[model samples]
Target: MFYWRRVGRIWPVHLVALPLGIYAFYVAAKVDIDWPGLISSVFLVQTWFPDVTPTLPGNPVTWTLSVELLFYALFPLVAPFADRMRTRWLMVATAVGLFGMYLVNWVADATLDPTMARWVMRHPLVYLPEFLLGMTMALALRRGWRLPLHPVVPLAGLFGWTYLYYQERWPFSDVVEHQMEFAMRPMVGVLSALIILAFLQREARGHRGILNNRLLVSLGLWSYSFYLVHHAISRLATYEFGRMPDNNAVLFTLIGMAVVINVICWALFTYVEEPAEKWWRKHTPKRWLDRGGETGGSALPPAPRREAETAPAPV
Candidate 1:
């Protein structure tokens, strides 16, 4: 039950967070939320609609969930085809998919106003290539292909690209600058995949790194909850306190908020995400999950669980 597993992984936290975030917005921002948008948002289809009010409703950050939902719906169809392709060919297809995003972005930027262009670029369909890129890397790794990459190279590239692109520091013609702007999504996707591949290779080879420790690993586990709730908290804080003066004193406020966010995320993960996922798996319908004339639910044979690398990639 791939669909079931994905639903179980994603929905439990969303269900809890959605209303809570809506309430936070109501109290803090007094946002003129488009109510009908909530329905699409709950279904994780809000990003597919150009008319979505305020772009996202409820938890504004849940647009990523919309993207994930699209990926889940398409993964089975894509996976069978992807699994059959040789690693080289699979990468070729991924590259093409990513290139398609640049064209889509270019066309949207050329044809639409800035806001509509932004929305078009953000559409879930436009992001499927990033998902494919991750999958391609996973398959290539499994196929015993290795790249001579250190994580730092791509990590640095990511930071450098973000700075230069956002600040428009490079001397380029207007058309070239526009190309770089549109090219960001795909470029970042490739860089991100490379960073992940470097670490994946290291972990596969039984090496340990700073992130392999339990504290950070647990933080990583809590990150989804952190992502879900952090914005609401920030919204509430900003509304209550107003903007802090742009001085080092703001670091104290940031540190305090970070602590509070982690504490809340820890509670959310413990009470919601972990328990819900376990229960979801425990209760999945046999007919949906079992096809081999075998026992159902959590009865599948156990394997070494490197939870560090998985929370099932729904991210």
Candidate 2:
């Protein structure tokens, strides 16, 4: 939601992040240890330096931002192609091509021992498939692809993810140690596609399942902000309280903190994100062409056309 809105009006989302960024910096600075490493990690500048800790609040998740940035840069170009090729075959081809690329890369990495393969995986080229999966699902629905609603898909996805996390021991376990884990990434993509398709199809049929509720929609709206700041919030909370000894106590405390922080972040998102977006649309120099053949100053162009417009104009 925030990504779409940001693409529509970039400046507002940047403005919204200012305070959050400041808060992150403030917290990091007040901490008693390793201010330089924290600063480098938080801003993702540590990626350039060798000695910096690889794992930090902001370092690990910065790849997602890179992926989002790539989307923002390429969306304008792909939007037209995606709009034109609205066939199920096109979607399938794209999905296959993306996965094929990953397979090729994985094979090459194994053969040549490319030290940078992990970094390459973090690149936007790799994860674009996941976002493309979502977009294709949306287009599939627009073309009347019916979604299967049996609980089997979601249940399978849940169990599969849990098993991958526990059995494979993520991050530490290599592809050689656990080929199943590496293979399951694409399956996770498939599962996510199914879940998204189900929700969209339900909404199209005017049947609200769980996501259509006002509160859930609101949470969805705020989910971006929550994702961005939740780690920092969690770290701060944990730091303030010190580490709990009991496993159950620690788990419960973390869960409670997550809930409280998510609520607060949601409120901030609604107030800061929405209003700032509106303000940007009003003031920004960008212009968007509307579907009604009119010009609007909004940042997002109209949604893609569902059907061909003029039958190729007789060539």
Q: Relative to the unseen true structure, what is the C-alpha lDDT of residue 202 in candidate 2, on a scale of 0 to 100?
A: 59
Q: Write the per-residue lDDT of candidate 2 for residues 1-315, one digit (tens) a residue.
A: 333445544334434553454455455546333556556544434344434443232334453664666677666567566756755666787678667655855764666444455544455566677767766666556555564575456757768676866775655646554455444556667776777666665566677687767988877887767766676566565567766676666787778887897787777677776777676555444333233223333333444655543122210
Residue pairs in collision within model 1: none
Clashes of 2: 1
Off by over 4 Å in 2: 1-62, 108-115, 168-177, 244-246, 286-315
Poorest 10 consecutive residues of model 2 by lDDT? 306-315
Point to the candidate with the largest TM-score.
Answer: 1
Task: Estimate TM-scores for all models.
Answer: 0.88, 0.71
What local distance difference test score does each model get? 0.82, 0.58
Instruction: Write down the TM-score for model 2.
Output: 0.71
